[model samples]
Target: MKSQMLPTIFIMTLALSVCGVYSGKVLVFPIDGSHWINMNILIKELYSRGHTVTVFRSSGSWYIKESSPHYNSITVEDVAGGFDEDFLKMLISRIIQIQADGKSSWKRLQVEWELMKLGPVMTQMEINVLAKLLDDHKLMQSLRDAKYDLVLADPVGASGGIIAHYLNLPLVFNVRWTVHSEGHFAIAPSPMSYVPMPMFELADKMSFLERVSNVFFFAFYEFQAQFLIRPLWATFTNKYFGPDVDYFQLIQGADIWLMRVDFVFEFPRPTMPNVVYMGGFQCKPAKPLPQDLEDFVQSSGEHGVVIMSLGTLVSELPRRVVEEMAAAFAQLPQKVIMRYTGEKPSTLGNNTLLVEWLPQNDLLGHSKTRAFVAHGGTNGVQEAIYHGVPILGVPLMFDQPDNLSRMRAKGAAKVMDIFSVNRDTFLQALQEVLHEPFYRENMQRLSRLHRDQPMQPLDRALFWIEFVMRNKGAAHLRTESYKMPWYSYHSVDVILFLLAVLATFMASFVFGIKFLCTKVCCKHKSKLE
Candidate 1:
């Protein structure tokens, strides 16, 4: 009986070790503030589910340090030496130099500037440079030593995707906004369609000229892929890593793509098989607003409060714009709190207060805070929606225009061009949003829709992660479309049909001429006989 009991105990212990314990490690890379927030929530969820999580982020990111107690954090060093400062100086010097030069040189400079203005192309170039840095053999050896089972990367991180390819591990990509899906064959709508171009200016729509511009933009991307990106990536991978690392292979290695956008704010579109929409994962009804903030709102009397932020990256707006905004707020009946990183404006009025930073979620959730004036970043947009606050978006760059346009189309916000912005238009837009209850009602309706999903976004993300681990890769869920030719993917069969029709018409014309010539010769021969 003692021997039998010993055997039973051994079997139980082995089962517990094998089945209940997971040894897999997940490495996450978030490049910016928004990505940091999204990945932090995902890391916490992964940790609670009994997986070890590690994070890599940019050096200056605040959220990475804030999340140290929750997960292992590593900062990517700025290896380019004083590159950022030097780069800015060079840009300014070039501009001034070109201005002093003759018209031909200035025209050349303008052309170069236009090339830089193409956001997607510039982003791709930056991604290529980072990919080369990450492909260094030393870095690869270090990652290999870590023995991670999977790598989770933000698409914007650039290097992570390439590193995952080198390590031969399953990679999951996180896109924090809508425009990241451009050029990828996915069901998501191209948010770039909403961004107005200089050739075509309209609200909530793109014109024919805009469509033509997009075609040229797409062509430019392809050009970069063939000429710049492909060669650079190949050389880096071959020199430091191995010959097997290729651009197409890097894209194919991704097991899943996660987007941080809710379906409520976006229209239903065809989605790829492994693509998942997990937007608003970080949003929740946070703890009550601080007592002082609440008291301030309560003391504002019948007039409401306005929450204004330029987001993290663009925290310092031009001083003139700040003064104009302050002056505009002075006239409005609302109590305004502006989040500015630098010195406060000199003309700040009685109804307004300036702070370096405010707890954004807490302020947005306050009942007195009726509207948000924001830079149209995804994090800010999601928080505004979650708290049922309307927005007046002053888009800066990249996807902000598209994000703002989508909100306006939903009847939940208004968009103001930042360059042309002033006190009168700003005040009128603010009053319209606060005076009309429709904006608030629309936001609430969208919030309910977003919150009505079958599973909480974080839980859904966790389930997918576990599912991928258990299955040893989610490759079965991936689509064959990834293997299809570019023309086939975009459905160019109609063009082929038109070409075929043209060919048949030309053939029939040649055959008719031959037949007529033959008949004329035979008739002439009969007359001679």
Candidate 2:
């Protein structure tokens, strides 16, 4: 009896040790500060659940690397060094070129459009290069040596996905936007519009002309990707590393895709098994507002305050636009805090304070804050809606314009053009937004809808992650899509075949009737004679 008891105790001790070892390694890749915040929240949640997490990020990212003894940071180089200057010049030139060419320069215009679309893809490629660089720097080698059980990555960072692919670890792709009906994923509202495209908005609902236009669009992207972007990535990889690498393969192998959009913000649609919506995961009440911000809000009193931020990507606004905004804010009765990274414009009035950085979530959560002036970034838009704050969106590019348009259409927000924005227009928009109770009501309604979930978004996301891990790839969830060819998938060949068969049948029937009529006419003529 004593020997049997000793054996059971030893087995229990071994099991505990194995569980502890399994919980000690999770590798995360965060490309930007927002991603850092998001991943940090997730890591903290996992840590509380008894899992260890390490983050790999660029040095420029704002997350405090040394804060936690458990947290380890691996730095990557800034490949886009001084790129802001070049990017600004290029943007101006492209805008001018688009205006000058109009519809006449279709080919060149298409090229320019493709280049714009390729922005995110190119950024990912650069990240992939950076990942390989990190690999050489001994970070990836250490991770491999450590034998991490999972590799969680932001979709924007190529290294995370690439390393996961190479290491044959479970890979989770985190998306920060809504998924589209066309199977393409959008990170934010396509600077095109805001009201989410419903599931009914599929290719079948389009007119014949619209379908044709879509064909052309798809063809253009395919051409650009195959000829330009793919080649560029291949060349970079080959030159940097050796000939053993396959650039395209790295993109195809994510085990699971996680999205940061909620059903309230986006329409419900049939999604691939691997795609999971995890939006609003990091949206929780944080610490109190800074003393200075608190004092400023108190100073505003009954009139309340408006918080403005254009997001990190477009931190530097055009000087003219800034001046116009300053003039507009000067007339507004509400106190305004604008987050601007550039030099403080001399034209800003007493009502407006230009700060280099402000805690956005804290500001939004403030009782005195009534409205948001934003770029309609996914995070910003969601945060505004979550906090029940009305918005005035000055969308600049990509999904921002689309997002703002949707918000405006929903009567929850107003849209202002970035290029031609001025004092009068800004003032009127502000007045309408501040005075209108409907906007706040609508925002609150959305906030309620967003929160009416069966499970917290973070929990749901984590469950899916563990589900995939436990199920050994979650193959049961995958659509039979991998089995079909492109033509079959689109049903183009089926349509073409049916059209051919119908055409043949019609031609044969028409010819047979014509021959019969001719014979009857001859017989009738002979009988008459």
Candidate 3:
């Protein structure tokens, strides 16, 4: 049976590849976030093939000008300058900091920020971005005229979905699995029983207490988004999507959610067919390391080198953190290449090299690189996995802990809490991953699985993208469970029905017992008489 399946699958794949250029006009509307890195890969591949790809992005977004006949871009003037990229980073930082402080005043402030300031400001930002896309009447008409096959929607925000629906285009989502929100969960199967919410960073198998907390985690998430955030955003959303449309409903519009995750790392969870796993699609062939970096690693002798980075979102860390990190590296025999964006630390050891930015993937791919010590971001973690480098994860906030947890679970990494980090603990973590053989072996095993796929991640992504195009967004693959209400999804009605029947049977049995007792007592009285 397995042998037959392989031959048949190969035949079908061949058919898909040679299906005679069912080329498409794909509209790419990637959100201006960490998502852009992968989208850049997707765009390039689509154009490299025969497909006509057009992107609605800002002026300064990473793209070559008129790169090819098939490649094109449309820059929205207002979107280019309107949204403040730093504002979001600052807001998230402030929120996380306040949550850490846990003062009554801070709690009140967080509430006010979320209820009054955060929602309104974020809503206006989305409004500005989308309005700019639609504001030009002529541009809107031209987009209508182009007859796009599908809209590649970023699953993070509502603007992309709104635009796609307005244009009557089928929407396919490229999602990050670790997003773990009420809105994103709606895209596919996310049973509250086992699927750990990204916010909690709990393992797939939870303790009784953890499960209890997980339930509340979900409840609050759903409550906050549906009740608090939606009302505020809806005013702006309704203005654009028309008065009748529900803001929360926009997330459900995705015909497919191409999640950036693999089951090998994540815990086993139920997923529907349309929730396609296209994880590590961003793993590309590593370019050669710069000569200077190569020379630096070569100077490490037999100790090799370890790379450190906190990724873009949390590049500028606290001074103490940097000081401790430097102290930790100073103790290690291995040389370190630390990528930091803020002011360079003064505690520089001769073995430590600090750069504002580094080619992380290139460094990880290097043969002598011993370990990675950094903020546990999905991108960085995936890159490390691809390069077979073990990690010393310094998890800060959001999905970082969860990403780190997965790495730790895989036996390829160890997690040190950023909040509770000390020189002793930090240095030990670095040493353990560097010195251990199992860490390297486990990572190598994962790397083999990642690369050993029948087709590469990029090819698979392209195939699915074109498949969606060819199959009109592949609506047939969508699960009916998406359309189900919360009650129906969990089968509340079925439970109620069974409970009612059990109650009826119990009542009848009690009545029968009482009648038999009465008959026996009457017979006893007759015998006495």
Name the candidate that leads on TM-score.
3
**lDDT score at residue 482, model 1, on the 0-100 scale:** 46
TM agreement with the true structure for every prediction: 0.78, 0.74, 0.84
User: For model 2, how does the per-residue alpha-carbon lDDT over 210-263 read when each residue is reduced to its tens digit?
Assistant: 555555654555565566566655665676566666554453456677777765
Model 2 worst lDDT window (10 residues) = 186-195
Candidates arranged by lDDT, highest first: 3, 1, 2
Clashes in predicted model 2: 15
C-alpha RMSD for every candidate: 6.5, 7.0, 6.5
Model 3 pairs in collision: none
RMSD of 2: 7.0
Whole-model alpha-carbon lDDT for candidate 1: 0.69
Cα-lDDT of candidate 2: 0.68
- Over the stretch 1-529, how does candidate 3's per-residue lDDT look in tens digits? 9988999999999988878678799988776667777777788788878788887776544333424464577876555344446665776677556544333555644644553456545566666777777778899999999999989867666766777888888887777731126234776567667888774568888888998988887887667677656776678766776777765565675777777887766777777677777778887667888899889999999999989998776657666767777888888889999988877777668899999889998898888899998788888998998889998888766567778888787888888766556678888888788888989999999888887777776777778888888877777777656456778888898899889999999999999999999999999999999
For candidate 3, the 10 contiguous residues with the lowest summed lDDT are 177-186
List model 1 lDDT by residue over 1-529, tens digit each.
9988998999999998878866568887665555566777887778876788888654544556735655787655544332233343344345434433223545544744544444344355455446545656686588789888788887653466666776777888776431223413333334456533211123435577766666565555556556655665577668756885565556655787787776675544456678777877778776687787777778788888998997765546566677778888899888998888766887688988787778898788777888999888888898888888999888755456667777887889988865456789888888888889999899988888888879988777777777777666788777656456668766698689888999999899899999999999999999999
> Which residue runs of candidate 1 sit more than 4 Å off their true CA positions?
1-23, 57-63, 74-77, 82-142, 176-207, 220-228, 238-245, 480-529
Residue 269 shift from truth in candidate 2, angstroms: 3.7
